[model samples]
Target: MPVVSRFLGIIIAMYWDDHAPPHFHAKYAEYEITVNIRTGVVEGKFPKRALRHVLEWYEIHREELIENWELCQNDESPKSIEPLE
Candidate 1:
């Protein structure tokens, strides 16, 4: 897994050649989740505050996330994304 963004103590990453739906993995403290890039569907858990921050960041960087996903699908190094301020 390669970390592409980190903010508010939340780490966002993606695996090389990962599964369908084009998603990214986010981990905050003991909570973690995989969020679908296109639909905002989340598959794990995060504190309400952390999840909010992650979603906000996601909205702002959705395009970058998709580009990273494509790079990951090809086993290429994903560029680091901007973190939430």
Candidate 2:
């Protein structure tokens, strides 16, 4: 997994050769969730407030996320994304 962003204690990552739906992983403390880059649908668990932040960040970086997803699918390292301020 390559970490692409980190802010407010949240870690965002994309895995190499990962599954479909083109998702990225978000981890905060003990919570970890996989969010689809296209739809912003999340799978797994995260605190409500934290999830909101992640969704907002996703909205801002949707295109970048898709690009990174493609890179990861080809076994390339994902580039870092700007974190939500």
Residues 2-62 of candidate 2 have per-residue lDDT tens digits of 9999999999999998889899999999999999887788999999999999999999999
The parts of candidate 2 lying over 4 Å away from their true place are none
Q: What do the candidate models score in CA lDDT, each in turn?
A: 0.94, 0.94
Model 1 CA deviation exceeding 4 Å by range: none
Candidate 1: deviation at residue 64, Å? Answer: 0.4
Q: After superposition, how far is residue 23 of candidate 1 from its true place, in Å?
A: 0.1
Model 2 TM-score relative to the real fold: 0.96
- Cα lDDT of model 1 overall? 0.94
